[model samples]
Target: MLHQSRQSITCELDAGNSNCLTITACYAANLNTERSDLWVDLINVQQQLSLDSSPWVVGGDFNQISHFSEHSLPSVNCYDSPMSEFRDTLSHLGIFDLRFTRPLHTWSNKCPSSRIAKKLDRILVNQPWVSSFPHSQATFLPPDISDHAPAILNLAVNLPTSGTKPFKFFNYLTKHPLFYQTVLQAWHQSGSIAWDLSHLCVKLKKIKSDIKKLNRENFSDIQERVRVANRLLNDAQVLALTHPTQENFLKEKELHDKWEFLRTIEESYFRQRSRINWLREGDHNTTFFHRLMQVRNSYNSIRSFTLSTGEVVTDPVVMGVIAISHFQQLLAPQTTLTSPCSLAWFQALSPFRCPESNAQAMILLPSDEEIERMLFKLNANKTSGPDSLTSELLKAAWNFLGAEALPWEYRSKDIWIQLKQVSEHTGSLL
Candidate 1:
């Protein structure tokens, strides 16, 4: 039965025995709704699917691309918010995308003028059902009647595996009551801090190397190796927790935690490195910003640092400014003084004298040659010639003194004043 907005038709397959399979064909319209409505719809679908006793398979055109990478059109605008929310919904309901292994462009128009393709259709199945149907595969059929291409998926019933192995808890057994206490005793015996850190680093490195060797040999899966390492780490953590005062145990525990954090960082670096290479080749600054936000959000799990005002500023721009300012401070010159001689000091050493109105004696100013040398030194520091800066400073001095002396009065004073004002106004001041 077909319905609007949210509709799913459930069908039961008659497989001889009491065992049966239920299939749901669902279709959701492309329309924006309030978050609550979306949540309600997702919950309704999930509850309906949960009623099935047999293997459940949901297949239909979801009208959504699971990721931004699925779209390749230059002009097509892709948004991550809705897609991210949808993925979260699927994950919350224990559903895995069955179409992840194939290319994103499933439907393409063969028309000469308008050519468009998109992977709006998808198939989601439970892991147990997927494992049971090993030979089943989903394929996009050729377009014939409509713009969308129908997807065909082959299905199989339950199958048995080779053997049932015992549940392995990795290295959990190594931290048994007897072995853990022995390791703790040995750790307590190691007294030196530096030696303890070095030893812990060596042990962690050896464990990681062993895991890598096993992975390279294709002997075990990553989950197994991680489980084993995690057990060992948990044992170390327990010992540390038991002996809070033991410095060596605490150091070893910290080292183990750091190794895990480093591994996470390495994984994230590789993930972003691939995305950055793709972004460099394409004009997708918007996508780059979106990915940057995701990475920044991931940093929230790390240690938190607060500002002086007790506000936490995690924005990239603020972080970048802090980093740049720190670098500049580190590289700044040792002294703030611009020149060896102050303006007052130079004035005091002058030979020329200015007649004072209040004082009985005349105040001595610098001679033309000595003033020229001082001006040269000042202008040298500012990359402006002595003639220009000295001329401007003198004009300013004359203005401050309220002197309107004519050009010929002080050997072309008018021309000098005009040039000086022009230079100062034009920012040519030393």
Candidate 2:
């Protein structure tokens, strides 16, 4: 935090799980920036701080809008000089509006006939802030005393859940009696489209629906089934022990196996939730497993943090921003002077003279077959993505894939072209 006043309070923080410093700030911009110059002062103050790779956030009633959509009332220009300056400052500082989960407008001018509502308040986070808390989100709460609604920041700190989660093929699904048959029916019923790069994406996307339906029919109420299995097993055991018949013993064996199978399913569910690697998977009764869960919740959880300036912060977004700003300052490249000899050497070195054809060949796009093979080769058992997509599902649905599937999710041709552009742009900027 660099400044603190009635209208604004700045805070800097470095909390657990965040390696960088974050800047959390609240700024109440003067209604007319030209009259008060609050925005100008903000820009000047930020100029004094090193912000490379840092995260900074500013939220409050700026009395300004970056875009026309933010302003409810129609205006001739929509962007005045003050709003334009504010937008430009954000662009230069690499700050963006935090992802929020409520209405954009934070203030309301109680004009019953012609309500003049505008997003006068907002939270902005720098790139580093986003990197630190990818699941962070903002929500607008009801305005009770004031006209402006309060915005709440939610950092996804809760344990992961699979409820309505994106479809991913589990190894256990293959054990079902009609697993392949169900998939076959779903595939045959699914309408065919032109085979294109999106074949896998399309097929996978459609398969999720079928999988969901199958799960609803077969996998729901698993615990209830387990209890029912236990009752049946008890009856079979009684007959086996009292009657002492071979058929009764076989029935008892079958019931026990069924109960164990149900229990195994329950274990798999918890193991996935625990996310601890228990190679010996007969049962999950380890202290380490519980400790892992505690650790995850601990590292991810953020109750409060204190800024370098002594102000305590409880908001997650604020902490995230302050940490980002701190890291940006910390990790920024140290300033150095170029030696004359180095400059001379650079001037003497010849430019690359490779043939245009060779350069083009080097940048050529990978073949579809190569890409498909690579996609399948990626490990199937593990998922390391936000979507939780597993490679097993892709491999299983490979035969049902369409040409557009790959392109739907990842258009290699477009991605490669964009990458080349980014590379060239990066060189120029450097």
Candidate 3:
């Protein structure tokens, strides 16, 4: 161990280009014990973190759980304040509980009838550490030296090498207050265009370039600012609790608000990366999202594939072309037969539900009330589009953009849509 204290031992090891600081500590051997002092110190270190502090790898027999689910068949009586504090401490410090391969209790009370099991030991890491070593795994070994199972963190695992990744619009980028302004700045730099469609295409291209430059300037490493903010917030909170001075109160509020803002950014980053559409907001699922991304990356990866002519191809460009060609061929348009079948026969095959009453009926455009309902019904946490626009943003900016939704239309499939006629006004710049 590199550093040790009364309750914990810390060992910092260089992993890849960054360093990992592993902290292990034991609260107590018995079921219930007072260890708030130990937790306070850990939080203290987490709060006073420097700009260049190593990625944290904290784990041990914490002897508590933030939520009852970590313990076996828990109920109301199993609640503990210190355990809550422990959970909060990890969360406030931006640490995550690394899940084991198999779900099992780390410590079991050796009795048969009254046997009790709990997951008291866990290995956790910050966002920076997990991002650096995405393939890191944690395993639970059988109890030997003590009653608790040894939690082993294998941090040096390497993921299979793949080619350049595709560009994906991150939902979190939209959370920043300047996100919309940045897009406008990029679009404005594209210069004036005479035609609407051509202007749109050019503006979009310029916007992408501007966004890239903005990202490079603002977010080289995603969690660098977040860690610093968390540390400052921790210090401010501790001071507020201990002293409760007026100046400290204002400082705590500022830090708290800033931390929350950064936290939402972090959450959006994970959500987009996870690609899980049904997930809700305000849940502690950063690690879950990280794992989901890993699984998705593995599942969607094409290491190598053989063509129909038995030619094995491993080049990413070749693989992409082959896959694209295969799909394009399948979807390639065939000449429509002048008369594949009688019109009566095709009409008879079409699905109809009360056609006489519903098919001919037409509903007008939605009103303000209907539009409001539609906006509220959307899942705000779902992924955003390439423009970094999301349902949540649209809802928030409804005052400005709500009326513009009149031009947008939603089409439902019945048999085939037939737009009989359309009209447009033509105009030119002076």
Error of 3 at 62 (Å): 35
Which candidate would rank higher by TM-score, 1 or 3?
3
CA shift of 253, model 1, Å: 31
Query: Per-residue lDDT tens digits of candidate 3, residues 1-430?
Result: 5556666766556554545455545454343344666676677666655312456777787777676767776453565776677777776777776644444678888878977888878877766555556567676887986788987777654443457653444545565678777765554566663133333334444555665666666655667777888999999999999999999999999999998777767766766767776767878576677666755553354456667675657676777778788877787655576946887787799665465546455544456676678766876555554344456645544453344333233222320221211101100100
Cα error of candidate 3 at position 191, Å: 9.2
- Rank by TM-score (best first): 3, 2, 1
When summed lDDT is taken over every stretch of 10 residues in candidate 3, the lowest stretch is 421-430
For model 2, state the Cα shift of residue 386 in Å: 5.2
lDDT of 1: 0.47
| Candidate 1 per-residue lDDT over residues 84-160, each given as its tens digit | 77777777766555533234566555675877677767777654444345445565665577766677776631122
Model 3 per-residue lDDT at 264: 67
Candidate closest to the true structure, highest TM-score:
3
The segments of candidate 3 whose C-alpha lies over 4 angstroms from its true place after superposition are: 1-167, 179-220, 234-253, 276-280, 333-342, 348-353, 362-372, 383-393, 396-402, 408-430
lDDT of each residue in 1-430, candidate 2, tens digit only: 6676556666777656745554545556456644246655566556766554565666766777787778776663466776677788777766777766456788888779988887878887765566566656666876888888888876653433323544544544555667667776776666566343233234444555777677667666766887899999999998889999999999999999988887766555444545655356666343334434343443454555656675667666677677778777897646688756776577579765689999899987667687787776764335334334455555555665424444443444465554444332222111
> Would you list the C-alpha lDDT of every candidate in the order shown?
0.47, 0.62, 0.61
Better of 1 and 3 by lDDT: 3
Q: Which stretches of candidate 1 lie over 4 Å from their true place?
A: 1-6, 15-18, 34-39, 48-54, 75-78, 99-103, 109-114, 157-430
